[model samples]
Target: MSIPKRVAERITNRIKQFQSILDAQRARDVSEADTVTLVKDLLSEVFGYDKYAELTSEHSIRGTYCDLAVKIESKLALLIEVKAIGTELRDQHIKQAIDYAANEGCEWVVLTNAVEWRMYHVLFRKPIDKQELAQLNLLTIDTKQDECMERLYLLTREGFVKSALAEYRDRKEATSRFMLAAILLHSGPVQTALRREVRRVSEMLVDPAEIDKILRDEVIKRECIEGEQADAAARRVQRSAEKSIRRASEECEGSEANPNPSESPPVQDAH
Candidate 1:
């Protein structure tokens, strides 16, 4: 997505300015409370949030509070969990954030330590899950790089308003290795195409079953084809294929039922 020129410029300037603040904070080894304050400032100054209105420290879920919650127009946009500047972000931090999001039925959360920011998409499943959409460190990234800038832009106010992060999440899921692997392994059309190519190249007929076995056993990695993520991808592909088939069938039935209205049957009888 192309960010507006003004927003892009603001991101560039803030990234540079925050790099200095992050450096000083890390040197001082600030407390978690201090880090939360820095994060609120970052949200306001860098991410285009109103400090007093949009950013909240009192958003509680199940008797616990998220460090910061971004609410635009009184709707919760995202939950942020902060760690101390000197502390390393870990899975535990993400779990806490995800718990808050799950209870509130929110889909997005962020974990930051005033320097490194990790954005996650929470899946409220039987057991809650999360997908890390983007991770960036202000001190390490080149602030002027477009890719880096774009990543930061996904967390900005404009990005939220545009649903850029959701779009990014969908794009990531659609093109993920597990999704691709699932398509290759389970998609019937893909299997047929693979079989045809094998016969054309080797001058020998290959059964679709044989091709599937070879791809699953040798060509594709086991991890990509055998995991909870892989299963989810496979289910998504199956659902998509089923929908396509249903639409085609419905169109065919409609065409058969509705013959050409322009054709007149026995119009000559009137003459």
Candidate 2:
């Protein structure tokens, strides 16, 4: 999880306790109140939130109350929307919490029941988008799973205090965009790399026009450039395309002038 020694210890205990809670639920009826209590416990025990100072339950925002809200250093940091135990959390639950956060000008929210936790980044661009950062089941994880533990750390008090989740989300988004641009047709960086790779591994040389056609038809199906995001790579991609076309034209002319050996090879066959 890249967490300090103490936070790692806390995560181990939290995972074990959560597993025990689910195991005991084999017979006991778990109510919404029970779920809320569990959430509070996790906030205090696992995440290290001070029950009295950092956690607020039934937090009201303009008359609409969410299950919990977190405050750190007198600044509102996160809002949590709780669903009842055994309830299947869905997009509607996320939207509701996001709406509440929007009203409060909050950027982060956690939507969870007693068993599952889903963290989201509320993108308030034009239409608000709930971009999920991570989700996991408390009942299904190993105590020492590093991947899951890192995700869990995103919501921990020590993590939030240090803006860990925020940084994690930003890094993730940046990586995603880079990947999209790499495979996407309108990415200059990837086009240049792709040309080099294609020439390096193959005997056949293809032009950028053919590459674009292939990428558009066979490779990239998702729209990578949308709204403001297009501005980042559009110009570069256009320039690449243009340069590619010029090189392709020059290659075609050279090939035509010095035709292939199979077609016409300096009259060597006459010898």
Against the true structure, candidate 1 reaches a TM-score of: 0.94
What overall lDDT, based on C-alpha atoms, would model 1 receive against the true structure? 0.89
What tens digits encode model 1's per-residue C-alpha lDDT throughout 1-271?
A: 7889999888778878888889999999999999999999888888898999999999888888788999999999899989999999897888878988988999999999989999999987879899899999988977577888889889999999999999999988889999999999878798788888889999999777788889899999999988799999999989988999999999999888877867776645654
lDDT, candidate 2, at 14 = 72
Task: Give the Å shift of residue 206 in candidate 1.
Answer: 0.7
Please list the residue runs of candidate 2 whose C-alpha ends up more than 4 Å from where it truly belongs after superposition: 25-27, 177-179, 182-184, 223-271
For model 2 the local lDDT of residue 111 reads 90
TM-score, per-candidate, Cα-based: 0.94, 0.78
Q: What tens digits encode model 2's per-residue C-alpha lDDT throughout 118-191? A: 99999887677777898888888665778888888898998997888899887776666544654366656677
